[model samples]
Target: MQSMTGFGRAEHADDGLIARVEIATVNRKQADIHFSLPRELTALEADLRKLVLRFISRGRANISIHLERVSGCDDSFSVDPDRARALETAFNKISDLIGRPVALEASDFIKAPGVLTFSNSVWDVNEAEKAIHPALETSLKNLVQMRKAEGADLKTDFLKRLNTLETYSSVIGKATSNVVERQRELLHNRLREAEIEIDLNDERLLKEIALFADRCDISEETTRLASHINRFREYLDSSEPVGRSLDFLCQEINREFNTIGSKANDAGIGQSVVGAKTELEKIREQVQNIE
Candidate 1:
């Protein structure tokens, strides 16, 4: 099991270049990857996306990659001669405006913006991949680790809630154990109070009671609800991703509870059905974060 929310970062330095990769993920129904890469590395986006998919099957992942030369290293830059000429012309105009000749210093030109540009590193795709792949893989591994850790915690909470659900189901079962008999007694008392003096064993009276018992019966619903709960417990221990499956089971469980609530016709069973539904709602909320 794994969670949909996690963060990871890694940096790799080689051949005077440092590659830094950061990944953040959040809950999403599908795998959605967004990347922030240097222009030189744009060509590698497809390959990088494939790697991300290998680690994450469902979530919105934001990946950022930065490549920079080591401090005090200047080998990755080239002077733009045309830009330098433009700067020189601008400097000459500035000197004239001041009515004095301004000295042209190498340091001044080197410090000027747009005079130097990063080299065309994309010319060698293999080299760029070599520098980035290690950092990217390490960051993804870290992200998976964090996700699994949180998933363990979520599993614990799910088990606790499942226990609560079972408790409510038990209460409903007990409350409805003799519901038919109770209803039959209530019907007889009502008939007596109305002074109808009808035959207790009349075919019409027995038929009406039988119909009422069938309508108020929730045995099928309770049985199905228990089955759904057991299926959910099995999913919690599954090795594969079960978020979607668990979500579907939650819906089924809620449906059973709804049926039970409506047919119960007793206050105690109705309250138990409500409690079970409440627990199922919470489980559904947490299931969204699972992967």
Candidate 2:
């Protein structure tokens, strides 16, 4: 088992370049990856996405990559000579029109829009991959480790809740066993108190009691609930992604519990069903975080 929430970061410096990668994830029904990469690395988005998907099957993940050149690297900013010349000519014309010298400092032209252009570092795809892949691998390893640790904790909680559910299911089954007989006895006593003398073996009374028994019996629901619980436990032991599967199982469990609650008729059995459903609800919430 693994959780869908974790964070990891790694940095690597090589050949006058420093690369940093950070990855964060939260629980989601499907894998959704968003990346923040420098323009030079944008073309590698597909490969990066594939790498992330290989590690994470379900989550909303945010990946960010930052790259910086070492101090000794060549300058990345340059002035556009043509634009600077045009600006200078325009300034001289303005000065002639004003009939006075319009003094402009180098700082003015340097700061002008389009005068100074930043040159993006040329990147070799192979070199960039070599530098970034290791950092990404390290980050993913840490993320998985954290997720596994959290999954262990979640597993403990889920097991406790499952035990509670099982206990309540057992109680409900026992309470339901004699509920029909008890109801029939109570009905007979009420009829005698009301002075309604009917044959104890009347065909109508027997049919009504039989119908009541059928309506109140929750054996089928309890059996299915047990099956679902066992399947849920098996899924917990699985190594593959089981979040969706466990979620579906939780729905099935809740459905069976709801049927039992509605049909059990006896107060004690109803209460037990409620308790079991409560535990199952908690398990469902935890399953949402599993992957």
Candidate 3:
């Protein structure tokens, strides 16, 4: 199991160029990725998305890549002599027209647009891959590591909640074990209190008790609920993505709990059902974060 929430970052420096990659993921039903890359590296988005698919099957992933030259590296920068010369000439002409000589400083032209430009090292697909692959791989590995660790914690929590549900299930079973006999005794006590004398062995009274027992029978529901719990444990041990499957099982489990609550018709059993439902709800919320 793996969680869908994690963060990772890595950087690779090569030949005066540095490539940094950051990836963050959150819960999502499908594999959805958004990329923020320099314009020169935009063409590599498709390949990057494919690479992410290999690491995760479901989540919303955000990937950002930043490329820069070493702080003191000036080799990648070049002056456009043609543009600089044109600018100098234009400035000189303006100075002569104003009848005053104006001195041109190198800093003045350096700040001009296009006067000095750094070469875009990752302008090609091959160069972009060379610059980014190492950082991207490292970041992805870090992300998976974090996700796995969180998943372990989630599994532990889920197991504890499952134990709670099992305990509640046992409580409900015990509460309803002799539900019919208990109801019959209560009915008899009520008749005596009302000063109504009636034959205890009357066929009509016996038939009513039998009907009540049949109506409140929940053997099938409890059996199914137990089976669903077992299946849920199996899913937790699965290596593949089980978020959707576990979500579906949550619904099945809740349905069984509902049936048991209604059919058992005992206050103690109903309270146990409510507690089990609360635990199941927590599990369902955690399931949404699984991948």
Q: TM-score winner among the candidates?
A: 2
Number of clashes recorded per candidate: 0, 0, 0
In model 1, where is the ten-residue run with the lowest total lDDT? 117-126
Error of 1 at 116 (Å): 4.3
Q: Model 1 over residues 1-291: C-alpha lDDT tens digits?
A: 899999999989778777899999999999999999866568899999999988999999999988776677655777889989998999899999999999888887778876876663333566668778899999999999999999999999999998998899888888887887888788888999999787878887888889888998788987998899899889888878889999999999899899888888998888888788888899999999988
Please report the TM-score between candidate 3 and the true structure: 0.82
Between candidates 1 and 3, the one scoring higher on TM-score is 1
Clashing pairs in 3: none
Which has the greatest lDDT?
3
Candidate 2 residue spans exceeding 4 A from truth: 80-126, 199-201
Model 3 scores what on Cα lDDT? 0.87
lDDT of each: 0.87, 0.85, 0.87
Model 3: per-residue Cα lDDT over 226-290, one tens digit each: 89889988988888888898899999999999989889888888888999999999999999999
TM-score of each: 0.84, 0.85, 0.82
Span of ten consecutive residues with least summed lDDT in model 2: 117-126
Give the TM-score ranking, best first: 2, 1, 3
By how many angstroms RMSD does model 2 differ from the true structure? 4.0
Where does candidate 1 clash, by residue pair?
Answer: none
Query: Model 2 TM-score?
Result: 0.85
Query: Which is better, 1 or 2, measured by lDDT?
Result: 1
